[model samples]
Target: MDAQLGLRERKKARTRRAISEAAIALFLERGYDAVPVAEIAEAAEVSKRTLFAYFPTKDDLVLHRFADHEDEAARVVRARFAGETPLEALHRHQRAALERRDPITGLCDVPAVVAFHRLVAETPTLRSALLHYHARSVDALTSALLETTDGVAHQELTARLGASQVLTVLQELANTNQRRINEGRSADELASLALAEADHAFDLLRNGLAPYA
Candidate 1:
């Protein structure tokens, strides 16, 4: 039963990838707004119903890769080690992603990733979808923090504030990295600097921001 379930999941993942690749190629060949769902379904060799089964809306076809990470921050916080604080766990996670050159961490030189970033930045629709993903990340992180928190008055509010800061800092890092990539900077060239800058940002978050004002 487990093997069957796993096989089903692998098939679904392959189909999802096929649909996403088709959509991206068409979007890049033309413009995002110019591509139709029917064209994408045809390109992926799937019926419109099948494509919609994997991705509900038109935006989902292009942005579903981000859905995989929508709750990643919260998972990191929930799974922190005995002595690890949420920020510390998150910091380690970010650094590891950079070391692996994960495109989501802005530490990848993959042409597809660079092009995807450009599409998201330049296209109003995708930019809006990106915000939706970030909002989900913040919500998940806030919930995870609340679960482990105790005796703090207004714990919910505090969790939200912390979640906001952490996500915003990461977003800023990705933005900087993408801008650098646009300038022909390689991912390896940005890793050390990103790590240093990220460390400083996390320090400010950990130590509190009262010193900034």
Candidate 2:
């Protein structure tokens, strides 16, 4: 019984990948908005019904990877070390991602990845969806922060404000990296810049924006 279930799972995964790959190929070939689900199904040699089963909406075909990252920031906060603050954990995670050159970090800097980022940026609908996903991330992090602090005095307000700051910083970092890539910057150059940016961004959060003595 387990073997049968495993086989079924593997088959489903394969089908999903095939459909996604086909959709991306078509979108890349002839702009995202111009491509239709029926065309993608034909390209993948599957019926439209099967394609819809894997991806409920056209946007999902392009943005599925992003949706996975939505909960990551919150997860990092929840699993932070006992001595680590949520801000510290999130900063460390961002720095580690930059070092590893994670594409999702918006430091892909590769032509293909940069093109994908540009494609999403150029599409209003995709941009709206992306912003919605970012809001979800902020909400998740807010809940995690509240949980971690256990409803201390003003915890709700603090959590909401902190999540907003964190999300804004991250969005700025991603946008900067994407712009650098669009301007033909090398990955190594972007990585170095991102490291410095991460330090400055996190330092502000750590120490607050009070005037220095």
Candidate 3:
């Protein structure tokens, strides 16, 4: 039974990948709104019903790539060491992602990732969907920080503010990396710069930022 279930899962994953890849190719070639779901399904050699079963909305075809990172910040907070503050944990998490060249960290210069980002930037629908993902990440991070035993005064307000600030810092870091990549900077040429940016941003979070002009 377990083997059968494993096989089924693998088959489902394969189909989903095929559908998403086809959808992206079509979208990249002919703009997001210009490409119909029917064409995506046809390109994937799957029935429309099958495609919908895997991805409920058309946006899912492109945006699903981000689903894995949705709760990542929250998960990092929850998994922090006992002595670690939420801010510290978040900083460490961002550093690790940058070091590993994670795509969500937006440090990747791979052609496919570049194309995917270009599609999102050029497509209003996908850009809006990206905002939705970021909002959800903020909410999840807030919840995670609240779950920790930190003695933060006004926990709800603190959680929301902290989460918002951390996410904003991350978004800026990603934009800087992506901008450099688009300007023909290789990932190797930018790693140390990315690390320095992370250090600068996280230091502000670590040490209070109240005195800034």
Best by TM-score: 3
**Model 1 clashes, total count:** 0
lDDT tens digits, residue span 141-194, model 3: 999978874786998888888889998899889988998899999988999999
Residues forming the 10-long window of minimal summed lDDT in candidate 1: 100-109
List residue ranges in candidate 2 displaced over 4 A: 211-213
Q: What C-alpha root-mean-square deviation, in Å, does candidate 3 show against the real structure?
A: 1.3
Task: Pick out the ten consecutive residues of candidate 2 with the lowest summed lDDT.
Answer: 204-213
Per-residue lDDT tens digits for candidate 2, residues 1-213, read: 999999999999999999988887788789898998999999999999989988989998988879888989899998999999899899999999999888877888777788788888888888888887888898999999998777578999888888989988988898888888888888787788889998999999888776573
Give the per-residue lDDT digits (tens) of candidate 1, residues 1-213.
999999999999999899989999999989899999999999999999999998999989878888889899999998999999889999999989888887887767799899888888899998988898999899999999998789888999999999999999998988888899989999888889989988998899998976877
Q: Quantify all predictions' global Cα lDDT against the true fold.
A: 0.90, 0.87, 0.90
Better of 1 and 2 by TM-score: 1
* Backbone N/Cα/C clashes per model: 0, 0, 0
Pairs that collide, model 1: none
